[model samples]
Target: MPVSPAYRPDPRFFDLGPDYADAVKAAEFPKHILRHRNDRAAAEVGLETLSDAEWIAHLGRFEPLPGQPGPIAMRYHGHQFRTYNPDLGDGRGFLAAQMRQVDASVDRPQATSARGASDRLRLMDLGTKGSGTTPWSRMGDGRLTLKGGVREVLAAAMLEAQGVPTSRALSLVETGEALERGDEPSPTRSAVLVRLSHSHVRFGTFQRAAYHQRADQIETLVEHVRALYHPQVQPGDAPGLLAAIVEASARLTARWIAAGFVHGVLNTDNLNVTGESFDYGPWRFLPHYEPGFTAAYFDQFGLYAFARQPEAVFWNLTQLAGCLKLVADAGPLTDALNGFGPAYIRHLRTAFLDRLGVKSLGEAADQRLVDTTLALLRDKGEAVRWEPLFFDWFGGFSSSARALSGPRGKVWQGEAFDAFRFALFEHEPECPERLENPVFARPDPEEMLIDEVEAIWAAIDADDDWSIFKSKLARIEAARTGYGLG
Candidate 1:
């Protein structure tokens, strides 16, 4: 990731301390950083800037820094997969410290929040996953699997590379613990604490308060999010404030669809009020034309399938509306709820077209463009393979198909569109023709699971060489370019 302007953590909310070794172990974060075996890898990700002592002090313990306040466990409640569960909150996670005065784009206040053009604000609750249970775990363990950490890291990086707006991982550690789960030998577990643009507040956060009739807490939380994320809104106007948040949430969820991502779990608790993507679990990008693709094993009914994500988001927003009703201003609130469908569709169009690297769509009406592309991909029957076409074409790395479907259609050589034809913009596509040709590849009814994906990455991580991965990325870029969306 490219470095933004120098940023500082909020001193009032954090206190940096020394007794972090035990806390690190207790949190089950990987000791890999302490081991420093791959100093190169560590440095590649900005850890090299920290002195050894600073590294231990900042990351090891949940300590506050100078001018920063001490840590506190945040209060929240969430629904698990649509079932109303009011007892969930920061079971193991806590607000470690706040990153104050940053000029990072994610830190930039949303248009609703930038009244004075002052960009930075306080965003806390840097969640420490695998920290031993606090107030919320219920019957479950607070520990997370090492494989889970790896999967999250991969998901964040890959999604960001694909231009998906998401929470970025700050640090991942290999806590030297042997907790038996499944599939692995020792079932080693680890900790991955992330630096999120927003944290700890969820739709369940509001739902919990509203359910218990704690209108004050609900109002307080809403004010805090508005100040931090939607600063432009006046707190006194409860209905308008609720409307802005609803619109933001709806639009954020629409981007998920534009990118073909499935959250797999859309519980009220998992939905962040800050309009940021959080809680990565059982998430998958579509690999084929099937709109009903689901990433979660437990979703037998496809409650949160790829196509259903839009509706799921609106459903969650309705729960938000119910919570807003507690404020006793239901007039404008109803209008906002009714506006979700149209607003979501508008945002989806903007985001997906932007991904194609197009400035705007023309009025000459290229309806066939979308239809033909989908048909080609469906006929080719390789959804995962279809991604490469966009990567290459949109990146301006391929041009072989530039004349395709033109009046001089004589350039067409065969019935099937040659995937490698676009590669002429760079050099001859290096992969074998059989592999590049759309005919030989058949789409199987394949659905990628977390474990299956981990196995693939395990091989890559085990080898410690990224040439293969890099080549694979290049192939994907070529394919994306072919699809006019690299």
Candidate 2:
């Protein structure tokens, strides 16, 4: 196993003082059943070398990695359902560790030699949900139901497969315990989940400082973020950090919309500073391109509905901008916040094309294509669903006419699809050979609908059956490959 020097860990969150975090220990469980492990992500942090037992000990047992001392529950406050709540923090989760991931995604600059890999690295945080309790437990058990853990596992995988910038479920271990919950059956299963994300610091992290009138801490946070996440942001460049975060947030919002995912909760605390989507509680993929689609059963006002996602994201960005007011002037922060509209539109158009597996003809033609496609989906309404339409015409104008003539082709009629076809024909295909896979040869693409997800859970609940869940993951992987997104 090869390790990169990027594995160097710098424990910075503890610098915020004990007010920000409480050192915590993992709960002892009767059993540690390894359910899912993302080797791909493990490889990024130089941990793919660990054996299964060692992996469980490190992730599940909370054994501190090299340079990591212990876990700390971060402090923050956020507006839950638009009401500011100071009681909120990592009630059931904590930052387990932080490491630099060797990122091979960047292009080499002329200043570097071409023989070696690009030394650029991305900072990653190991966030464990339902691991144990800390100062912010709030009188609730700090354990996750096994079914809830499974649901989150599926949610992260599906989102990643659809090209969304999302946190990955690194490891899941069943802590042989019976958990009683009102949402599901009583005495339901229990487990621990570990999520690997770019950063655990949320917009609300700064909110807490602002709430306590701690401008100095806010400025310190700004400097910390600038040094770690955005080196391009020079010293005392508050506006530059805001712009970088805004751009990332804009892209994230657009990607979620393009993927047809409704993150039921868009609260500031759940919104990461790095702009990667994590902390999935109540999330859903739209059955169709319905704007009124709501994911949370308790979200009565549709605040975080499918169509209102971009709005909610921008609103969170505003709250983040408000925190930046402590260090930066209001003028430049407002200017950066105001850029979200145009940035969202631009990113949405590009993301829409990318999701459909098509290359852009140019800005004008691509925007036209995006507009027509969305217009068609809106007009079709209940007559068409989201996943199948893309599955039916993945290659756009050059999609298999024969494949369309099958069950998926039944709805390929009408003026809505006609407009889409004409607009799509203007652009070249991104990966035409993607349709050649046997997965695409089938009638339906891999979809993560509510019923399908429930059915998967039912299997787990009955006789410890995991075949359905495993096969579903396999199918989703095949779909990801079929879309040429792997």
Candidate 3:
């Protein structure tokens, strides 16, 4: 195993003791065909140098990294569709490994300072999906459909490109198995997915402690989270911890709105304490701006619809606050929970502006731009696609000529966009140079609509042809580079 120097294993979650998780073994599969490998993410954790065989041996077969212990199945309970489920846990996956990785957002110069090094490097986790069954399997087979893995990989890539804080799909290995899933075609293929994320500590982690009436465990959990993720907060400041999560989660929700993403399930377990999106199940990117559009077929009431996402997130925050009440004052927790509305509004403004690639004229003007843009999108109905509107008008008025002549030009020419056009022209482009990227020159933007996703999977399923999937990923990478939204 030729591991890079950047590989620094730190299995910190084990410090929480046996109550939080149980050590588990990966299931033996018949095959280990590599479907996708994220070399970019591998480099971050110093595993990029591994050969395909080595990669399969480690990620596919779940061989523990050097100095790393076996996989640990984390335990927690969460609300599924607002219904409390005590049996919910990592039924199919486990926290395989933990390590420190360079935070690319930090400046190298500042990294030399005493506090800078720690800030520059973040603790990342390698968590598995469809790897195997665990104590929490509950009589169900621990398997992930191949289509599910592909969808998640695509979702993670597009979300990252859109500057949304999300987990990176590190690896996907097709295991030789046939599984029957009611939602999809019978006897579908199976694969194991590995995700690289900031932390696996979910909102449900705290809920579990509170549910058990273990206030002492809640207190310890608070300390552990604050020490690793939010060091700025005082040791006993549980309310402050809740506030940090609230702010991050608010910003994340706003980003999802700007990206036209409907996270089909916004369950407490799906949302980590770090506010980074992960465990994507039945996620969808909007084709058009429709508030009532939903991603999951089972969401009969549209509780987590496109427009209702903000409300759903706020509700989840209150759940977390309820758990915090076990160790902290209710007044402070409620105050922190109340911050979601204001924080969401502020973040929505920033997120929309960033997506539009425009500089904010001022708070008032920016709000108008956001408001008018959404109004125009709503007005246009199905006549316009969501991503192309941003793609065409990126950099505001600077790209007006291009936007007016693009494929959606006819829609833009209508009277409905008059106010939106005026609002957009009021601001200048933030990164004018990004307009030169070849991705923006194309007639259409790269989109991950449901139809396109099905097409890509169809190619793979019918003929084992991965060209469409690979090409789409390449286009997404190009778009990510061109947008330069980060």
Candidate 4:
């Protein structure tokens, strides 16, 4: 038998280099490398052969880079639920390392890993819990709790399985350190998270640079984003680069909506310039379609509510556009703004239709059914109830199919729906077999918010009884894979 090529990590991402110590005062996690291993898939990668120490050393290696900010800090400002906040940067997290052009087979995007590359943007950051302050720590301890780490892992994994583009957890290790906090009982424990994704640059990053009037840095950061995520831009097409960013953002927000996910916070700092979803906390997945369902306890105004997400994204983009105006003209930028609505609508429609296994709305009636269902979901506050509808109908041939087509068809025949339905299915193929009755077998309302999920995790941590947690994960994973989200 022929010998295989020596196993290696993606060459592209082989240490893109980090701008370490550029802004060192902002660094809290003293350069300490923690040893870790791939308990999951080291075998497949042929990395199982590495001794434990070898793996740990590889995981712990941190190379500093030229021109990299000491804190990996970029400049930008952002709105917190529509309020202008001129002060914000990596308040707690710091860019620990950067792997350039890492080939992540998982996302199929050759970009720096968010957490670190195991086919994801693998990034390592020390989530400070009272790590004693930084430029962005505001008035509180920057410490994050162990419970918070657990919650973030669940949120990121759950959302990712649900077809939501989100941060992936590579590691979550408790730091044996104490810190004070008002949010939690004092002497908080900390954790480190290694995220996998394309990039971690945020709307806040751009906002910070813009706020400081560092137009040169803004331009540099824009180029960095483009080079990493949207390298298709021709030599002189800066406007195209901006538009590409806008388009990516639009598609991302649309996916969040289709998956029934509410980010809870769309703060400029939380909005990823790479158009990736970041900073998961107080996030909620709708059990029922409630327009006012708020995820964050702090979001008392529901600014990042389920229904307002798209609007929030558009608004964020407008803020980003303002920053871009420092360098670009107004006219083409206006064109980019106009693209958000239609592009988002198109993305949502395609993704939603795909989940239903509806090849095309072949008739106005078919369109009306979906439209009516969505309306009812929104009005009655029951979006999660529709999940089974997708499973039943799209699974093909069930009692629910008859309910969808026979008596229930009258909904589409109604005045408002009649014309819309006709136009919808006119050009599409019909899948009568795919229709299913919207029967809800369970009486209890479904919920998947951070707090609700934390309850399940509590059991896992306390008793290590993971039966319930495993079942929930299975159901959500089934939903994702069934709909091809996985």
lDDT of 3 by residue, 381-411 (tens): 8888899888999999889889888888878
- Compare the candidates by lDDT and give the number of the best one: 3
Worst 10 residues of 3 by lDDT: 107-116
* Model 1 lDDT, residue 62, Cα: 44
Q: Give me the candidate number with maximum TM-score.
A: 3
Kindly list the per-residue Cα lDDT of model 2 for residues 237-334, writing each as its tens digit. Answer: 88888888988899999999888899999999999878899988889999887888999999999999999999999899899899889888999999
Give each model a TM-score: 0.73, 0.94, 0.96, 0.73
Q: Which regions of candidate 1 deviate over 4 angstroms?
A: 1-7, 11-48, 104-125, 182-186, 362-379, 383-386, 395-452, 460-486
Q: Rate the local accuracy (lDDT) of all candidates.
A: 0.55, 0.83, 0.90, 0.55
Query: Which runs of model 4 end up more than 4 angstroms from their true locations?
Result: 1-75, 100-135, 138-140, 178-180, 184-189, 361-370, 379-386, 395-452, 460-479
Minimal lDDT window, size 10, model 1: 13-22
Per-residue accuracy of model 1 over 1-486 as CA lDDT, tens digit each: 111123344422222122110122235344534322222223322233556556555555544443335555555566677787767776655556554434445543322222234434545445556555655667756666655665665565455544556665555555656677654555554554544445556777778778889787667766766766676788756677667767777777777765667888888877776677766777887775567889898899999998888888888888888888887578888887888887876666555444443433442222323343445445556523434444333322222343333232342343334432322222222232223433213222122345557565566456644454334434434433333333
- Give the range of the ten consecutive residues with the poorest summed lDDT in model 2: 107-116
Candidate 4 RMSD to the correct structure: 7.0
User: Which TM-score value belongs to model 1?
Assistant: 0.73
Clash pairs for candidate 2: none
Clashes of each: 48, 0, 0, 49
